[model samples]
Target: MKSEYLRITGGTPLEGTVRAAGAKNAITKLLV
Candidate 1:
């Protein structure tokens, strides 16, 4: 599995890079 960096913002003025899976990975996991 691979990870991606996501920029989070808007909530509580959050600003940082978060480690996350790709959309495909998320959807695949959900399907499974």
Candidate 2:
């Protein structure tokens, strides 16, 4: 089987002391 990939073309701007929290998984879980 062949795997397929999707592409997203865009730009994200983080301004004014933006930050990513410590755990990504925790963030994803929290988001859900």
Candidate 3:
């Protein structure tokens, strides 16, 4: 079986507070 990815491709502004498990800083660094 194959895996699929959740992709968001478009020109727009995403505004909101996204909370996840663990440190928030870690998530930001991962994005960078």
Candidate 4:
């Protein structure tokens, strides 16, 4: 058997007016 690793980093250095909108019937599903 062997070993594994995962690394993740960094997001969003934002400096401004940001607007976001979603739908009326928004559905999200995630499976792992």
Candidate that scores best on lDDT:
3
- Candidate 1: which pairs clash? none
Estimate candidate 4's alpha-carbon lDDT, on a 0 to 1 scale: 0.31
- The digit string of per-residue lDDT tens for model 1 on 1-32 reads 86643343355664554334446456445434
Better of 3 and 4 by TM-score: 3
lDDT of 2 by residue, 1-32 (tens): 96433233458643453234556455445434
Which pairs of residues have clashing backbones in candidate 4?
none
Q: Assess the local accuracy of residue 22 in candidate 3 as a C-alpha lDDT between 0 and 100.
A: 59
* lDDT for each residue of candidate 4 in 1-32, tens digit (9 for 90 to 100): 85433222358453553222442123221111
Q: Alpha-carbon error at 24 in model 1, in Å?
A: 0.8
Candidate 1: worst-modelled 10 consecutive residues by lDDT: 13-22
Estimate, for each residue in 1-32, the C-alpha lDDT of model 3 and write its tens digit. 86433344568876765564556566565545
The collision pairs in model 2 are none
Total clashes in model 3, counting residue pairs 3 or more apart in sequence or in different chains: 0
Q: Worst 10-residue stretch by lDDT in candidate 4? A: 23-32
**Can you give the lDDT of residue 30 in candidate 4?**
14
Candidate 3: where are CA atoms >4 Å away? Answer: 1-19
* Displacement of the residue 6 alpha carbon in candidate 1, Å: 24
